[model samples]
Target chain A: MNDKVRNSLFYVGGTAVGFVSGFFGGGGGMLCVPLLQFGGLDAKRAHASALLVILPICIISAAIYIKNGYFDVTAVLCACIGVVLGGIVGATALDKLNGTAVSIIFALLMIAIGIKSVIA
Target chain B: MTPQHVIIIVSALGGVIGGMGMGGGTLLIPLLTLAAGLEQHLAQAINLIAFVPMSVVALVIHKNNGYVSIAKSAPIVGCAAIGAVCGSFLARYAGGYELRASFGAFLIALGLIQMYKAISAVVKKKKASKNKSAQIKVG
Candidate 1:
């Protein structure tokens, strides 16, 4: 594909991914990684790039949420503490772990959660 | 466990998942709403907020591992930021019930796809190993 075409595609696809992340408040990376891969990135690169893409998107969206008074301060603070720690551990493990196995399990977890959310 | 404890544990788990590049919000939102009894929108908002720090950490790690490409990521980030703003507004306007239902449906579809990918990968790995062993025996 031409540079113009690839650039346009990335922009359009990024917009879609960002919208999902903002609207749903999660799952943006799932879509973003695949989109990056389609745009010619390797899996690992896609995953890493997706994180970069999502960081700004999430920050922007979260700011909007906070401005709109849609968040819980206490919950967010506690969750942040835990998520930061987990992030360190997870990032460290990425190089050493079997990502496929972890992914499979995560996928299963997603299915279970999705079903429960729909029914409840 | 205390609510605080629950929040910490779940958030940590979500962080780990996010660090893995699977999007922590997939797991975080549900845990918050279902287990912690948070409102749907609130849970979603919290997930987004938590994502900021988590993604930064993960990105830094990936960068060190030589997995990130800034040139490629720039366009996507710029466009995604625009889309995120629009989506945030839309979510704010949409009703909670509708939002929850749609999110659930999205999760189901994504989950099934993930499962298929994982299973195929396992099968392929097994087959490759088997072929390697057969070659060794013949030699």
Candidate 2:
């Protein structure tokens, strides 16, 4: 497709992905990575680029949540500390874990939790 | 451990998964709801806030390595902002039970898709190795 048409289509795709991220309060970056790849980025680049796109979406959603009185100072503070610390470890360890096994485990975990969420 | 410790430990677990480039926040929400005794909205809010700083550090590293391409994403980002506003409103109005149920559905969908992708990748790898061995034998 031509650049104009392709760009327009990606623009629409971005909105859809962004909406999902916002609606879920997260997970938009996972969707965005593939979209960016389709938009011509390599895998590593797509992953990095996805963070850029997701950061803003996250901020906006958080703002809305905070505005609507959903804010929790202690919970958020604690969670952020945990997330950052764990993020460092995870990133460093990413090179060591076999990709296929980790992904499979992750997918299964998601499915299990999802089932529980639906039932309970 | 206290509930606060549970919260920190669980959040760290999710963060580790997320830092590995998987969607940790997805897992974090459910962990918070199930294990941490957080309400759905509050859990979601915490996840959203937590993502900002984590992503910032990751972004800087990725950018330094020349992995980011923010130059061409302006239009996409603009449209995404509009979509985010609409989505945030939708989530705000949706009750906790409804949001929880729908998030469950979304997780199921994503999980299945990832499973398929992971399985296919493994299969492809096996096939590639098989071909390589056959070639070696022939040689």
The candidate that wins on DockQ is: 2
Q: Can you write out model 2's per-residue Cα lDDT over A7-119, one digit (the tens) per residue?
A: 88899899987898777787777778888988989988998888889899899999998998888888888898899889889989999999999999999999999999889
lDDT of 2: 0.88
| Tens digit per residue, CA lDDT, model 1, B1-139 | 8998888998888778766667776888888888888888898899888777666766777899999988778877888998899999889888877877788899889989988988998999999999999999999
Q: Across residues B1-139, which tens digit of lDDT does each residue of candidate 2 receive? A: 8888889999999999999999898899988988899998889889989999988988999999999998755558988888888988888888888888888988999999999999999999999999999999999
**Can you give the TM-score per candidate against the true fold?**
0.90, 0.95
| Poorly placed runs, candidate 2 (over 4 Å) | A1-5
Residues A1-120, candidate 1: write the lDDT tens digits. Answer: 888887778789999999999998878888888888988899889888888888888889989988989977799898889888887777678788887888888888888888888888
Q: Which pairs clash (backbone N, Cα, C closer than 3 Å) in model 2? A: none
Interface RMSD of 2: 1.1
